[model samples]
Every structure is written in structure tokens, then in C-alpha cells.
Target chain A: MESFSRIPSHIGIIPDGNRRWAQEKGYQKKDGYQHGITPGFQLYEILLQYGIKEATFYGFTKDNNKRAKDQREAFTNACVDAVELLSGRDANLLVIGNTNYPAFPEALKQYANHRVHFGRGLININFLVNYDWEWDLKSLMENKCLASHEISRIDLIIRWGGRHRLSGFLPAQSVYADLYIIDDYWPDFKTSHFLDALRWYQDCDVTLGG
Target chain B: MESFSRIPSHIGIIPDGNRRWAQEKGYQKKDGYQHGITPGFQLYEILLQYGIKEATFYGFTKDNNKRAKDQREAFTNACVDAVELLSGRDANLLVIGNTNYPAFPEALKQYANHRVHFGRGLININFLVNYDWEWDLKSLMENKCLASHEISRIDLIIRWGGRHRLSGFLPAQSVYADLYIIDDYWPDFKTSHFLDALRWYQDCDVTLGG
Candidate 1:
């Protein structure tokens, strides 16, 4: 078994390139969402196995919602399905997003901005849906200071599908995070890939800029 | 002449591994700071030549203050010298960092939190010295909202040194920024490396998660 001397306390992920994955497979862009949904749980299982304290997934962003209507619908459905699948798991699930968006998935309606099954298990899982950095910053302005640490500071950020940008996953939370990028699309995500990221995180000297 | 279809509007950089660079050369860690100082100007020359709009350097962060006194002194001197060197230039220069830090460079006292020498080159140059993410966030809380756009949203972030983390380089500005990392240390940085980053960026499809 692969081992890391240290495991990041909280990891954030941006799984990208579903449309490209679908197009390359000669499938419709919507079909890619179906394939993309499975990796979320796979990643969670691995994080849980390692006893990682927390994991955050970029479920969907405002920028993501602006995609073609069909693409948006597919993504919303996939997230709902992923939530349904995770509901049976032994973990705390929280959805943090701008639920004000019109197409916010109905399946996650009850869990919006709240933690569900809080007493469940070894890991805390966060999914951001219809999230926007601008929206989050705006709220910070109005609220003065947030009392609750809703978003844990990210230790590592992994982006799948070869893209190098955060696309506004969770900037405030990612302030001091290490970033890892993989060319593999979300649908093709493997346990080995997750292991490799953990290993990479282990190799880093977390000087925090010192 | 090298060309890019779209050039980034603002670029943020984290120059790392100066000590490691010195160690590799069989010299004291402090000696590396001397070699690292010149590259900042070299990078500016290249960016100015290319007419790139803006560049931000992570000259020092608050966490960096925790290093050995000698090391911290070396970094502060290097930054003060760099700021003094740029003071005579045609570009606008700004320093975004915690000036409250007792050891904050005396040479940079004039340019603190304000843009300096708003003239010559088309490029806007920002150097972050003694910066802390938490400090900036706190100021945002007190002042209501930042006016005059203290930091332009970063388009691309490049870190020299093999590490892949931002280590607290301007998280809010980096919300949707593309990240590029190089294995070379700051002292070893070359103009060719900057050009290569532009080339790599040109090949990216900046869908911004849509």
C-alpha cells in the first residue's frame, strides 16, 4: 500500500472537462455529466479510507451554470444523483453554494447551506453548487465578518482534466493551499491518481511562504 | 518575434527556492538572495518588452518573517533594494503587505499601500512585501470595500521552484487565475522561462468553467 507521511487535513477539488471527455468519446456533452458523477464518491471513499478530516468538491459554479442549457441540466441531475448516492454513506454532507440560482438542484434543496447527517462518520464532505466567488465576496461585505468557519482552509487543491485555473472553486478557503493538476478527465479518475496527489502533497515543504 | 493570441492582463508570481538555489551552488542560503534579486528586473524587462499589462510579485509574506533572523534580514534588504531600483522607473509600482511588521523595510516606507511613479512603461508593477492574506481580509472587513481596485484579478500565477502551492499569495485575486509552476529557483529564472509560460498559456482553452 502507498503511504504518505502526512495527509492534508482538508482537500478541495475541481473536476473539469466533462464536455471534452464526452466529445472525445463521440458522446453528447450531457452524457459526460453521467460519467463525471461517479468520481466524487470514489474520491470520498479514498479520503475516508485515509481518515482525512475533510474534503470539498466543486459541485457547480455560477460560471458553470452559464454553460448551454442542456449542459446545465445534465450537471444538475448528476449532482442530485451524486447526493442521492452519498446519502447512504457514513459521512457528514454539506452543500455550500449560492442556492439563489434558479436551477439549483431540487435534490440538494434540503441540504443547502446546511450540514446533513452531521453525526455520521470519519470525514466531513462539502459540495459547492451554483457557487460564485463574486457572490461569496459580496456576502462577506454585507455580513461584516463570518462567525462560523463554514469553509475550511484548503490544504491541497486538485484540478482534473488538465486545466490549470481554479475557475473560482473557493478562493478564500484556498488562500494557502497547494495545487495539483492532472490531465485525466473526471470520468477517468483513478485511485492511483488520488494516491499520486497525496504523495505529491507529502513531498511539499509546507513552509507557508517562510 | 514570439506572439500570443491572448496575453494575460495581470500576472502574479511566487519566486521560491532561493535558499535551495544557493545550497545547490555550494553557497550560503543568504547568498541566494543576492542572485535572486536581479531576476525581478529581468522579468520586468521582458514583460515591458512584451507590453504585458501588469505583474505582481510575492516579494515577501508575513509567514516569511518567521525564518531565522539572518534570513529575514536578507529578504528585507533585497526587497528594499528592489523597490529602490524600481523607484526610478517609468511604471507604477505598488507594495501590498503588512507594513505594521516592525522589520518592514525602511526604504519602502514611502511606497507602502500606494502606487508609486505612475508614469513611463505601459505596465503596472506590484511588489508584495510583508503581506499576509488574513491582514488583507481584515482590512476588507473594516474599510467596507476596497476602492481603486488594490489588486487586479490575477490572470496567471507562476511559481518558481519545484513546489506547486501558492503558499498564501493573493487568494482572492487568484479566484479564476491560471497557475503555472516551474522547477527552476528564482535565481535560475530566465527570460526564456517567462516566454515559455506565455506560450503554454496560449495553448490553454480558458473556458472559465463554463
Candidate 2:
């Protein structure tokens, strides 16, 4: 593996198009979220290998809960499973979101707001569950504290499934993020897709308007 | 000349690469900003022809003032010129920025915060001068109101000069913007580039995370 001279300290992941991927594969929309779990693990291992300091994954959004009942339950459960999967790993995992909402997973509420160490805690992992951009920013207005205040600024944001839009990602943190998009769906995660993004990041100005 | 059945009512423009474009043309970096003015008018006309309701153009940023003295002056003057250029046109013009700072142009102080109607006010134009994402969102924390409260949600964000990053262009409003990148520099503005982006946006699943 070619090592990067300047690896991004924090990477934001938008694993999109799972349902579309499942539909194309002739599976129920609910079944797509299950397949996305392995990709999360695959990306985690890759991040660990690269010694990336932190990562934030889009688990499910508040708007995402607007999905059909079965689809919503599937993705919500998938997020819980993903967090549990990281429990035994060497990660400082924290799930940030609106836990007050019923869409927030009951099993994952333990990981919300505060970071819990799993093993050596080599990398910081932030999983956004039932997250909303308005809800995230509203904290600053209503409470004078951000729910996502613990997470640092994102250096690069990689989105799967060919969407160019941010879809309400952490706006404050992602202000200067170098965005990379992959046409492949989240279920069809490939190491090369991530590697390609890293290579592209090397050439970015990364000057934050300086 | 073809009209779109579904035109994005509000479009955000990130006209990047003025310095690079000037350097490539064997001109001083300061000269780049002057050349970018024509494209602004061209884009405005196109938007008016298509009956697009609102548009936002990224002027200089607070960070941009960190550049060389001449370069800062050049871009600052360019933003002032761009706003003045729109004064006689049929648009509602507003400049959002930190006017308290010395970096903001004196000529643009009147346009800040409040929207001034031009001839007939057929379209709304927002020019972000000395804008910062942190500063824009910080208003919510300290003042309980956004500095950019007048702007509506951005439907599509078009960036000229090949960069895929947002570089802090109205973060709150751009949560669901369909980002389109054109490798061509701002000085090299072609109507076809805007047309191509519209064509791409036509296929976008603009369903805000639903």
C-alpha cells in the first residue's frame, strides 16, 4: 500500500445509495441497510491502516426517518449494529444525534454525546444517528452548545452513489472539506474507491482560503 | 436557447480560480479579479432569461484578505464593482459580510444586511463579501439571528475553476444544493458551462434526503 505523505486527520463518510443498490440487485429496500454494514467495517480497517486520527460516518439523518416504516427501521438497526461492531475495536466511538427523537436507536443511546473507549482507542469514530443539520446548528442557538461540538473539523468528505450534494452533512465542520464522490453505491464498497480519493486529496490546495 | 422545465429557483455561484487564470494568461494576479466581472454580468443575464428567482455569488472571503496587499485590494474592488454593476439591473441585491472588519469595502457598506431593489427586481442576487461560514453561523450563538437570514435555501451551487469543495459558501442554505463543478476558470466563463450544469441537475434526485 502506498502511504500518503499528508493524510487527512478527520474524514467524513456519506455512504449513500444503499436502497438503490438493493433495488438494482432485486432485494427489498430494507435488506440494503444490512449489506452496508460490511462496508463500514471495511472503511474502518482502511482508516486504521492509514493511521487516520478521526472519522465521522452518516448513519442516518432526521430526514432519512421520513422513509417508509420498514426502510427506516432497517437503517436505524443497521446504525446500531455498526456501533456495536466497533465496540470491541480500538476506537473512541461517539454517536452524535437527536436522541430525543424516537428514530434514535435505543441500543445506541449509550454512545451518544460522550466518547467511550473500546480497546486502545487508536482512532476517534463519530457516528451520526438521527442527525439533522438544523438540529445540530439549533443547539448553538437554543442551548449555546453544539451536539457535535466534540467532533473536530472534517478534512475530507467522501460520498458514495454519485450524489454531489452535501444532504445536510455537518455544515460548520465541513466548511473547508475537500469533497470526493464515487459513483458506486455504499453496499459495493471498494478499497480502491477510498484510495482514489486519498490520491486526489494530495493535490488539493487545502489552503482554507489562505 | 432551450428552456428548462425544472429550473433551480435559487443557484449559488462559486467563481474560483481568478488568480490562477490571470497567471496562466501572463498577467499579474491582481488583474484576474477585473476580468471576472464580465462573467458575473453574463451569468446574471442568463439567470434572468431563464426566470431563475434567486442567485448567490461568492465575493471575497475574510480569509481572502490574508493574501498579498495588492491581491486583496484587487478582489475587494472587484466585489464592489460587481455589486455596483448590478445596481441598474432588474434584481434585488444584498451583500452579506462582516462590515465591521477593515477588509470590507467602504462602497459596499450600504448593501449589507438589507436588500436593495434594482430596476424592476425580477431576480434576487446575493453577493457574499468578506463572508465566513463560522462568522455567519456564529450570529445564531451570540445574536440569536443569522447574518444571512435573508437568503433562501440554495438548490444548485455551481463552482467555476474545477475545485469540488464548497470553501464556506453559505453552509446553512447549501445543505441540499446540487454542486456542479466546471474546470474552466471564472474568466473563461461560457454560457455552455451553466447550461451543462442545468442539464446535469435535471437528472439529480433533489429529494432532500427523503
> Please, what are the lDDT tens digits per residue for candidate 2 over residues B1-210?
886768998999999989999999999999999999999999999999988999999998987878999999999889888888789789999899999899988999999989999999999999999998788998999888778989999999999999998888899999999999999999999999999999988888778877
RMSD of each: 1.9, 0.9
Alpha carbon deviation, residue A145, candidate 2 (Å): 2.8
Which runs of model 2 end up more than 4 angstroms from their true locations?
none
lDDT of 1 at A24: 98
Deviation in angstroms for B98 in model 2? 0.8
* Ten-residue stretch with the least lDDT total in model 1 chain A: A140-149
- Look at candidate 2 and tell me the lDDT of residue B121: 99
True contacts kept of each: 0.84, 0.84
Judging by DockQ against the true structure, name the best candidate: 2
Instruction: Report the number of clashing residue pairs per model.
Output: 1, 0
The best candidate in terms of TM-score: 2
